[model samples]
Target: MIVTASSITFITPQVATARAFYERYFDTWSPFDCGWYVLVRLGKEPDAPEIGFMEPRDGAEPFRAGGMLNLTVDDVDHMHARMSSAGETIVIPLADNPWGHRGFGVIDPAGVVVYCHKAIPASDAFAPFIQKGPDVPRGA
Candidate 1:
Protein backbone atom coordinates (compact mmCIF):
# COMPACT_ATOMS: atom_id res chain seq x y z
CA MET A 1 0.00 0.00 0.00
CA ILE A 2 1.19 3.50 -0.82
CA VAL A 3 0.57 6.21 1.75
CA THR A 4 -0.34 9.65 0.47
CA ALA A 5 -0.88 11.95 3.45
CA SER A 6 -1.02 11.89 7.21
CA SER A 7 -2.26 13.87 10.20
CA ILE A 8 -2.62 13.59 13.96
CA THR A 9 -5.78 14.68 15.72
CA PHE A 10 -5.81 15.48 19.40
CA ILE A 11 -8.91 15.79 21.49
CA THR A 12 -8.45 18.53 24.02
CA PRO A 13 -10.57 20.98 25.91
CA GLN A 14 -8.13 23.79 25.10
CA VAL A 15 -8.47 23.66 21.36
CA ALA A 16 -7.89 27.39 20.97
CA THR A 17 -4.81 27.29 23.14
CA ALA A 18 -3.33 24.39 21.21
CA ARG A 19 -4.05 26.11 17.91
CA ALA A 20 -2.49 29.34 19.17
CA PHE A 21 0.63 27.53 20.35
CA TYR A 22 1.24 25.92 16.96
CA GLU A 23 0.57 29.20 15.16
CA ARG A 24 3.02 31.04 17.38
CA TYR A 25 5.85 28.50 17.37
CA PHE A 26 5.60 26.84 13.96
CA ASP A 27 5.77 29.76 11.55
CA THR A 28 5.26 27.69 8.39
CA TRP A 29 1.96 26.18 9.48
CA SER A 30 -1.42 27.40 8.20
CA PRO A 31 -4.50 26.87 10.28
CA PHE A 32 -8.05 25.99 9.24
CA ASP A 33 -9.95 27.22 12.26
CA CYS A 34 -13.52 25.98 12.65
CA GLY A 35 -14.63 26.99 16.13
CA TRP A 36 -14.51 23.57 17.84
CA TYR A 37 -11.85 22.21 15.50
CA VAL A 38 -8.58 23.53 14.12
CA LEU A 39 -6.43 21.86 11.46
CA VAL A 40 -2.91 23.20 11.16
CA ARG A 41 -0.92 22.31 8.06
CA LEU A 42 2.87 22.21 8.29
CA GLY A 43 3.63 23.77 4.94
CA LYS A 44 2.08 25.15 1.75
CA GLU A 45 2.29 21.81 -0.04
CA PRO A 46 -0.96 19.90 -0.18
CA ASP A 47 0.62 16.72 1.17
CA ALA A 48 2.30 18.39 4.11
CA PRO A 49 1.58 16.86 7.47
CA GLU A 50 -1.22 18.39 9.49
CA ILE A 51 -2.03 18.51 13.18
CA GLY A 52 -5.63 18.74 14.27
CA PHE A 53 -7.04 20.05 17.49
CA MET A 54 -10.63 19.52 18.52
CA GLU A 55 -12.82 19.95 21.55
CA PRO A 56 -13.68 16.66 23.21
CA ARG A 57 -17.09 15.36 22.27
CA ASP A 58 -19.59 13.99 24.75
CA GLY A 59 -18.14 10.91 26.51
CA ALA A 60 -14.91 11.26 24.54
CA GLU A 61 -11.73 11.29 26.54
CA PRO A 62 -9.49 14.30 26.06
CA PHE A 63 -5.76 13.75 25.60
CA ARG A 64 -4.31 14.03 29.05
CA ALA A 65 -0.71 12.91 28.70
CA GLY A 66 1.82 10.21 27.67
CA GLY A 67 2.25 10.92 23.97
CA MET A 68 4.87 12.92 22.09
CA LEU A 69 5.13 14.67 18.74
CA ASN A 70 8.53 14.71 17.06
CA LEU A 71 9.22 17.77 14.94
CA THR A 72 12.43 18.08 12.95
CA VAL A 73 13.69 21.59 12.27
CA ASP A 74 16.53 23.06 10.28
CA ASP A 75 18.27 24.49 13.29
CA VAL A 76 17.54 23.06 16.68
CA ASP A 77 19.74 25.55 18.53
CA HIS A 78 17.99 28.55 17.00
CA MET A 79 14.60 27.08 17.83
CA HIS A 80 15.72 26.35 21.36
CA ALA A 81 16.76 29.95 21.80
CA ARG A 82 13.50 31.28 20.36
CA MET A 83 11.38 29.08 22.59
CA SER A 84 13.52 29.89 25.61
CA SER A 85 13.20 33.63 25.07
CA ALA A 86 9.46 33.25 24.69
CA GLY A 87 9.24 31.68 28.16
CA GLU A 88 7.97 28.37 26.85
CA THR A 89 8.36 25.39 29.11
CA ILE A 90 11.39 23.34 28.20
CA VAL A 91 10.81 19.99 29.82
CA ILE A 92 13.94 18.41 28.36
CA PRO A 93 16.95 20.65 27.87
CA LEU A 94 18.52 20.58 24.42
CA ALA A 95 21.03 17.75 24.12
CA ASP A 96 22.62 15.42 21.64
CA ASN A 97 21.23 11.94 21.16
CA PRO A 98 23.20 8.88 20.16
CA TRP A 99 20.56 8.12 17.52
CA GLY A 100 21.65 11.08 15.37
CA HIS A 101 19.86 14.19 16.60
CA ARG A 102 20.25 17.23 18.77
CA GLY A 103 16.91 18.01 20.36
CA PHE A 104 14.79 19.04 23.25
CA GLY A 105 11.27 18.54 24.47
CA VAL A 106 8.64 21.16 25.22
CA ILE A 107 5.21 20.66 26.69
CA ASP A 108 2.43 22.43 24.87
CA PRO A 109 -0.43 24.15 26.67
CA ALA A 110 -2.55 21.06 26.11
CA GLY A 111 0.08 18.90 27.84
CA VAL A 112 1.35 17.30 24.63
CA VAL A 113 5.10 16.81 24.45
CA VAL A 114 6.65 18.23 21.31
CA TYR A 115 10.18 16.95 20.76
CA CYS A 116 12.01 19.35 18.49
CA HIS A 117 15.21 18.19 16.87
CA LYS A 118 17.76 18.59 14.08
CA ALA A 119 19.79 15.87 12.44
CA ILE A 120 23.32 15.26 13.60
CA PRO A 121 25.86 12.54 12.89
CA ALA A 122 24.96 9.40 14.75
CA SER A 123 27.15 8.15 17.54
CA ASP A 124 29.15 5.00 16.93
CA ALA A 125 26.70 2.93 18.91
CA PHE A 126 23.79 3.92 16.70
CA ALA A 127 25.52 4.34 13.33
CA PRO A 128 25.05 0.71 12.31
CA PHE A 129 21.30 0.96 12.75
CA ILE A 130 20.99 4.02 10.48
CA GLN A 131 19.94 3.08 6.97
CA LYS A 132 20.01 4.79 3.56
CA GLY A 133 17.83 3.89 0.60
CA PRO A 134 17.18 4.96 -2.96
CA ASP A 135 13.48 5.44 -2.32
CA VAL A 136 14.11 7.63 0.72
CA PRO A 137 13.23 11.24 0.05
CA ARG A 138 16.20 13.58 0.16
CA GLY A 139 16.69 17.17 1.35
CA ALA A 140 14.22 18.51 3.84
Candidate 2:
Protein backbone atom coordinates (compact mmCIF):
# COMPACT_ATOMS: atom_id res chain seq x y z
CA MET A 1 0.00 0.00 0.00
CA ILE A 2 1.18 3.47 -0.77
CA VAL A 3 1.61 5.72 2.26
CA THR A 4 -0.06 9.03 1.54
CA ALA A 5 0.56 10.79 4.83
CA SER A 6 1.97 10.28 8.30
CA SER A 7 2.32 11.81 11.75
CA ILE A 8 3.74 10.95 15.16
CA THR A 9 1.77 12.15 18.13
CA PHE A 10 3.28 12.46 21.54
CA ILE A 11 0.94 12.06 24.47
CA THR A 12 1.97 14.49 27.14
CA PRO A 13 0.42 16.62 29.85
CA GLN A 14 2.33 19.67 28.67
CA VAL A 15 0.35 20.32 25.52
CA ALA A 16 0.80 24.05 25.22
CA THR A 17 4.42 23.83 26.26
CA ALA A 18 5.08 21.11 23.68
CA ARG A 19 3.41 23.14 20.96
CA ALA A 20 5.38 26.24 21.82
CA PHE A 21 8.64 24.33 21.99
CA TYR A 22 8.17 22.77 18.55
CA GLU A 23 7.14 26.11 17.10
CA ARG A 24 10.24 27.83 18.43
CA TYR A 25 12.66 25.00 17.66
CA PHE A 26 11.40 23.87 14.27
CA ASP A 27 9.93 27.15 13.05
CA THR A 28 6.53 25.55 12.54
CA TRP A 29 3.05 27.03 12.81
CA SER A 30 0.01 25.01 13.71
CA PRO A 31 -2.71 24.74 11.08
CA PHE A 32 -5.03 22.72 13.27
CA ASP A 33 -5.39 23.69 16.90
CA CYS A 34 -7.31 22.13 19.76
CA GLY A 35 -6.57 22.99 23.38
CA TRP A 36 -4.86 19.74 24.34
CA TYR A 37 -4.42 18.40 20.81
CA VAL A 38 -2.34 20.42 18.39
CA LEU A 39 -0.95 19.65 14.91
CA VAL A 40 1.99 21.36 13.33
CA ARG A 41 2.88 20.69 9.70
CA LEU A 42 6.60 20.78 9.15
CA GLY A 43 6.92 21.08 5.38
CA LYS A 44 5.36 22.93 2.47
CA GLU A 45 4.59 19.70 0.61
CA PRO A 46 1.07 18.40 0.84
CA ASP A 47 2.03 14.95 2.13
CA ALA A 48 4.37 16.09 4.84
CA PRO A 49 3.72 14.61 8.26
CA GLU A 50 1.74 16.75 10.68
CA ILE A 51 3.55 16.29 13.95
CA GLY A 52 1.16 16.69 16.83
CA PHE A 53 0.70 16.39 20.56
CA MET A 54 -2.18 15.03 22.63
CA GLU A 55 -3.06 14.59 26.28
CA PRO A 56 -3.12 11.13 27.75
CA ARG A 57 -6.68 9.92 28.19
CA ASP A 58 -7.98 8.73 31.55
CA GLY A 59 -6.78 5.20 32.39
CA ALA A 60 -4.22 5.40 29.61
CA GLU A 61 -0.67 4.39 30.39
CA PRO A 62 1.36 7.25 31.80
CA PHE A 63 3.85 8.87 29.49
CA ARG A 64 7.01 6.83 29.12
CA ALA A 65 10.24 7.31 27.29
CA GLY A 66 10.15 5.21 24.16
CA GLY A 67 11.05 6.33 20.66
CA MET A 68 12.37 9.55 19.26
CA LEU A 69 11.49 11.76 16.32
CA ASN A 70 14.41 11.42 13.95
CA LEU A 71 14.74 14.07 11.27
CA THR A 72 17.07 13.43 8.35
CA VAL A 73 18.54 16.78 7.52
CA ASP A 74 20.81 18.12 4.79
CA ASP A 75 23.32 19.67 7.15
CA VAL A 76 23.63 18.49 10.70
CA ASP A 77 26.43 20.91 11.45
CA HIS A 78 24.30 23.89 10.47
CA MET A 79 21.43 22.62 12.57
CA HIS A 80 23.76 22.05 15.51
CA ALA A 81 25.07 25.60 15.23
CA ARG A 82 21.58 27.11 15.07
CA MET A 83 20.37 24.98 17.98
CA SER A 84 23.45 25.81 20.02
CA SER A 85 23.16 29.54 19.39
CA ALA A 86 19.46 29.52 20.22
CA GLY A 87 20.25 27.85 23.56
CA GLU A 88 17.99 24.87 22.97
CA THR A 89 18.59 21.86 25.18
CA ILE A 90 21.34 19.91 23.45
CA VAL A 91 21.00 16.40 24.76
CA ILE A 92 23.76 15.07 22.50
CA PRO A 93 26.36 17.33 20.98
CA LEU A 94 27.17 17.02 17.29
CA ALA A 95 29.32 14.05 16.39
CA ASP A 96 29.73 11.25 13.90
CA ASN A 97 28.33 7.88 14.88
CA PRO A 98 29.33 4.31 14.10
CA TRP A 99 26.23 4.06 11.96
CA GLY A 100 27.69 6.48 9.44
CA HIS A 101 25.71 9.57 10.30
CA ARG A 102 26.72 13.02 11.47
CA GLY A 103 24.14 14.33 13.87
CA PHE A 104 23.04 15.85 17.12
CA GLY A 105 20.18 15.55 19.56
CA VAL A 106 18.01 17.92 21.55
CA ILE A 107 15.44 17.50 24.28
CA ASP A 108 12.07 19.11 23.76
CA PRO A 109 9.93 20.76 26.39
CA ALA A 110 8.19 17.49 27.15
CA GLY A 111 11.60 15.84 27.50
CA VAL A 112 11.23 13.83 24.28
CA VAL A 113 14.39 13.38 22.30
CA VAL A 114 14.66 14.84 18.79
CA TYR A 115 17.58 13.67 16.72
CA CYS A 116 18.62 15.45 13.52
CA HIS A 117 21.20 13.96 11.24
CA LYS A 118 22.87 13.87 7.83
CA ALA A 119 24.28 10.73 6.24
CA ILE A 120 28.01 10.37 5.86
CA PRO A 121 30.62 7.74 5.10
CA ALA A 122 31.89 5.91 8.13
CA SER A 123 35.40 6.77 9.12
CA ASP A 124 38.12 4.26 8.12
CA ALA A 125 38.53 3.22 11.74
CA PHE A 126 34.84 2.24 11.92
CA ALA A 127 34.23 1.31 8.27
CA PRO A 128 34.85 -2.40 8.46
CA PHE A 129 32.21 -2.97 11.09
CA ILE A 130 29.53 -0.99 9.27
CA GLN A 131 27.55 -1.74 6.16
CA LYS A 132 28.01 0.69 3.31
CA GLY A 133 25.34 2.40 1.29
CA PRO A 134 25.08 5.33 -1.07
CA ASP A 135 26.56 8.26 0.82
CA VAL A 136 23.98 10.55 -0.75
CA PRO A 137 20.64 9.70 -2.21
CA ARG A 138 20.50 9.71 -5.97
CA GLY A 139 19.04 12.95 -7.41
CA ALA A 140 19.15 14.56 -3.97
Candidate 3:
Protein backbone atom coordinates (compact mmCIF):
# COMPACT_ATOMS: atom_id res chain seq x y z
CA MET A 1 0.00 0.00 0.00
CA ILE A 2 1.31 3.42 -1.00
CA VAL A 3 0.05 5.92 1.53
CA THR A 4 1.32 9.30 2.64
CA ALA A 5 0.18 12.10 4.94
CA SER A 6 0.45 15.02 2.57
CA SER A 7 -1.57 17.47 0.40
CA ILE A 8 -2.73 20.99 1.22
CA THR A 9 -6.06 22.12 -0.16
CA PHE A 10 -7.06 25.70 -0.97
CA ILE A 11 -10.07 27.60 -2.22
CA THR A 12 -9.16 30.00 -4.97
CA PRO A 13 -11.09 32.13 -7.44
CA GLN A 14 -8.76 32.23 -10.44
CA VAL A 15 -6.97 28.96 -10.97
CA ALA A 16 -4.58 30.56 -13.42
CA THR A 17 -3.47 33.08 -10.88
CA ALA A 18 -3.01 30.41 -8.29
CA ARG A 19 -0.99 28.37 -10.76
CA ALA A 20 1.20 31.31 -11.65
CA PHE A 21 1.62 32.27 -8.00
CA TYR A 22 2.75 28.79 -7.09
CA GLU A 23 5.00 28.46 -10.12
CA ARG A 24 6.63 31.87 -9.87
CA TYR A 25 6.43 33.17 -6.32
CA PHE A 26 6.58 29.77 -4.68
CA ASP A 27 8.77 28.24 -7.39
CA THR A 28 6.54 25.18 -7.30
CA TRP A 29 6.77 22.69 -10.17
CA SER A 30 3.69 21.50 -12.01
CA PRO A 31 3.69 19.52 -15.24
CA PHE A 32 0.01 18.69 -15.57
CA ASP A 33 -2.81 21.21 -15.82
CA CYS A 34 -6.36 20.34 -16.63
CA GLY A 35 -9.96 21.47 -16.41
CA TRP A 36 -10.69 23.17 -13.06
CA TYR A 37 -7.49 21.83 -11.52
CA VAL A 38 -3.68 21.80 -11.62
CA LEU A 39 -1.31 19.35 -9.97
CA VAL A 40 1.82 21.00 -8.59
CA ARG A 41 4.84 19.08 -7.50
CA LEU A 42 6.61 20.03 -4.29
CA GLY A 43 9.90 18.32 -5.27
CA LYS A 44 9.52 15.44 -2.87
CA GLU A 45 9.84 11.69 -3.06
CA PRO A 46 6.95 9.18 -2.83
CA ASP A 47 4.92 11.85 -4.68
CA ALA A 48 3.91 13.88 -1.66
CA PRO A 49 3.10 17.57 -1.51
CA GLU A 50 3.25 20.30 1.09
CA ILE A 51 0.70 22.61 -0.43
CA GLY A 52 -1.96 22.91 -3.14
CA PHE A 53 -4.29 25.47 -4.77
CA MET A 54 -7.86 24.44 -5.44
CA GLU A 55 -10.39 26.68 -7.19
CA PRO A 56 -13.95 25.63 -6.60
CA ARG A 57 -16.57 26.53 -9.21
CA ASP A 58 -18.92 27.67 -6.49
CA GLY A 59 -16.43 29.99 -4.83
CA ALA A 60 -18.00 33.15 -6.20
CA GLU A 61 -20.58 33.50 -3.41
CA PRO A 62 -20.16 34.26 0.26
CA PHE A 63 -21.43 30.82 1.25
CA ARG A 64 -19.13 28.09 -0.02
CA ALA A 65 -19.42 24.35 -0.02
CA GLY A 66 -18.65 22.77 3.28
CA GLY A 67 -16.78 19.57 3.98
CA MET A 68 -14.56 20.12 0.97
CA LEU A 69 -11.31 18.20 1.27
CA ASN A 70 -9.37 16.26 -1.35
CA LEU A 71 -7.54 13.08 -0.43
CA THR A 72 -5.83 10.14 -2.11
CA VAL A 73 -5.68 6.78 -0.44
CA ASP A 74 -4.01 3.46 -1.26
CA ASP A 75 -7.10 1.28 -0.89
CA VAL A 76 -10.39 3.12 -0.71
CA ASP A 77 -12.42 -0.05 -0.24
CA HIS A 78 -10.48 -1.32 2.73
CA MET A 79 -10.35 2.10 4.30
CA HIS A 80 -14.07 2.71 3.75
CA ALA A 81 -14.94 -0.68 5.16
CA ARG A 82 -12.85 -0.16 8.26
CA MET A 83 -14.24 3.29 8.81
CA SER A 84 -17.82 2.15 8.19
CA SER A 85 -17.35 -0.60 10.70
CA ALA A 86 -16.26 2.07 13.14
CA GLY A 87 -19.53 3.96 12.57
CA GLU A 88 -18.44 6.40 9.96
CA THR A 89 -21.15 8.43 8.21
CA ILE A 90 -21.00 7.72 4.49
CA VAL A 91 -22.71 10.27 2.29
CA ILE A 92 -21.66 8.51 -0.90
CA PRO A 93 -21.51 4.78 -1.41
CA LEU A 94 -18.59 2.67 -2.65
CA ALA A 95 -18.83 2.71 -6.42
CA ASP A 96 -17.14 3.78 -9.63
CA ASN A 97 -17.90 6.98 -11.47
CA PRO A 98 -17.44 8.25 -15.02
CA TRP A 99 -14.62 10.58 -13.96
CA GLY A 100 -12.68 7.40 -13.11
CA HIS A 101 -11.93 5.85 -9.72
CA ARG A 102 -13.69 3.29 -7.60
CA GLY A 103 -14.29 4.73 -4.18
CA PHE A 104 -16.75 6.21 -1.71
CA GLY A 105 -16.92 9.28 0.50
CA VAL A 106 -17.92 10.11 4.05
CA ILE A 107 -18.32 13.14 6.25
CA ASP A 108 -15.78 13.21 9.04
CA PRO A 109 -16.53 14.17 12.61
CA ALA A 110 -15.74 17.72 11.62
CA GLY A 111 -18.14 17.49 8.66
CA VAL A 112 -15.33 17.38 6.11
CA VAL A 113 -15.97 15.48 2.89
CA VAL A 114 -13.01 13.17 2.62
CA TYR A 115 -12.78 11.38 -0.72
CA CYS A 116 -10.76 8.19 -0.31
CA HIS A 117 -9.58 7.15 -3.75
CA LYS A 118 -7.40 4.44 -5.27
CA ALA A 119 -5.95 4.69 -8.76
CA ILE A 120 -7.36 1.97 -10.97
CA PRO A 121 -4.99 -0.13 -13.03
CA ALA A 122 -5.50 -0.52 -16.81
CA SER A 123 -4.61 -4.20 -16.98
CA ASP A 124 -7.75 -5.07 -15.08
CA ALA A 125 -9.97 -4.07 -18.02
CA PHE A 126 -10.57 -7.72 -18.78
CA ALA A 127 -12.35 -8.14 -15.50
CA PRO A 128 -16.08 -8.82 -15.60
CA PHE A 129 -16.99 -5.33 -14.56
CA ILE A 130 -14.85 -2.23 -14.53
CA GLN A 131 -16.06 -0.10 -11.68
CA LYS A 132 -14.90 3.48 -11.61
CA GLY A 133 -13.06 2.84 -8.34
CA PRO A 134 -9.64 2.87 -9.99
CA ASP A 135 -8.81 4.83 -13.11
CA VAL A 136 -5.35 3.38 -13.75
CA PRO A 137 -4.60 -0.11 -14.96
CA ARG A 138 -3.91 -2.73 -12.27
CA GLY A 139 -1.16 -5.27 -12.71
CA ALA A 140 -0.64 -8.77 -11.41
Q: Which candidate achieves the best lDDT against the true structure?
A: 1
Tens-digit lDDT string for candidate 1 (37-94): 8898876777777999889888889998899999998889998999999999999999
Query: Is candidate 1 or 3 superior in lDDT?
Result: 1
Q: TM-score for every candidate vs. truth?
A: 0.89, 0.77, 0.42
The residue-by-residue lDDT of candidate 3 on 8-116, one tens digit each, is 5555555666565345422357656674666666444546565444556654432144655545667787777877886767888888755557778776432346676
Off by over 4 Å in 1: 28-31, 134-140
The CA lDDT at 44 in model 1 is: 70
Report lDDT (CA) for all predictions: 0.86, 0.78, 0.58
TM-score rank order: 1, 2, 3
TM-score winner between candidates 1 and 2? 1
Poorest 10 consecutive residues of model 1 by lDDT?
A: 131-140
Q: Model 1 compared with the native: what TM-score?
A: 0.89
Clashing pairs in 1: none
TM-score of 3: 0.42
Check candidate 2 and list the clashing pairs: none
Give the Å error, residue 123, model 2.
4.7
